[model samples]
Target: MSAHVRTPGWFTVNVLNRAVAWTARRGISVWGSRVLAVRGRTSGQWRTTPVNVLTVDGQQYLVAPRGHVQWTRNMRAAGGGELRLGRRVEVFSATEVADDDKAPLLRAYLRRWKAEVGVFFHGVGPESSDEELRRIAPDHPVFRITVTN
Candidate 1:
């Protein structure tokens, strides 16, 4: 297990994810959920997982609440991926956000999905101080993405 990754529990992996993926597959988005599809760095085959898309000031982002997980690693290597919502697939390019710049975004993310992903943030919530957010920023890799297709 990587130091940056925090593995989710059985319930989240089996039950919650499946439910979200199921709904997103059929075109229903739950709290900005989307099935992110990117190619594996080594295998070169497409890999996917459910992710929350955060939009602030018209810009879109993907924050890895689970730390540097597989999809985040893959996204770094692939430099882009697809956001799938049922029959709608939007291809996009991704740029990793600097850790220094993550605090505000993370705060906004917490403001929106704290109930669901806050646990992964290690007690940090929307109300956390900027210093507190920055302390954990590296553990949560954030990406700024733009849809190209």
Candidate 2:
């Protein structure tokens, strides 16, 4: 959690996120997108956002491409959340991955989402070296999640 959060652009925060959330809420997933609903750390109310779910080697992961943002902070405090794709809600627990273990997950994530989230990565891509990935790993928080119910 030593990494600084990268604030998103006006379009991302306003237009793009809203459109994606609207779609996901309607039961459509755009590029593995889902509506992530977790309790706010202080408010104790459910907060929703659109997120990309990356699966590697049969393991599911949530990578914070924009670094340590609000949802990541809430996830840390809540310990779990619900992934909503239309009416299907998958409740799950999350474990934050250490920086040392993030390289591979980040690589796979970039491979899948580079077109959409590459800008937030500061020029790193799926083709980047592991060393290069590790260099930026601390900035991106990753969570390994298990579906509980």
Candidate 3:
């Protein structure tokens, strides 16, 4: 059998996510919060969840700190999705970063969201070595977002 990534359970889904999604829907970004909507690979229906959209340098990214979750898989299959913050919705194409190219983005993501999702990264933090981050890159999927306008 193939290895599967761990997904969030009870409290994260029912409580934390509900609160985050509520705030994001109002355009009050709680640390770059946005609703990621992607079409399900099989169902073809839009599935949404609150996400942290990280902007590093001049580029925007979607980092899956929760590991290979459904959204990540859907994004891979769909090639694009929408990021909704209140009434503002941005349609964008996503390119999955290769494992070797993920170190910096992963580091930045941890620096910003470590308090919330650090447990999924084992013990690696923003201060961890590039080699260390590279080692765990496969577990987490990083997508580069390019606005389609």
- CA-lDDT, candidates in order: 0.93, 0.94, 0.92
Given candidate 2, what's the lDDT at residue 64?
94
Worst 10 residues of 2 by lDDT: 1-10
Give model 2's TM-score versus the native structure. Answer: 0.96
Please write out the lDDT profile of model 1 over residues 1-149, one tens digit for every residue: 23688888899889999999999999999999999999999999998889999999999999999899989889999999999999999999999999889999999999999988888988999999999999999899999999997
Worst 10 residues of 1 by lDDT: 1-10
Kindly list the per-residue Cα lDDT of model 3 for residues 55-125, writing each as its tens digit.
Answer: 99999999988778889989999999999999999999999989899999999999999998899898999
Candidate 1 lDDT score relative to the true structure: 0.93
What TM-score goes with each of the models?
Answer: 0.96, 0.96, 0.96
**lDDT rank, highest first?**
2, 1, 3
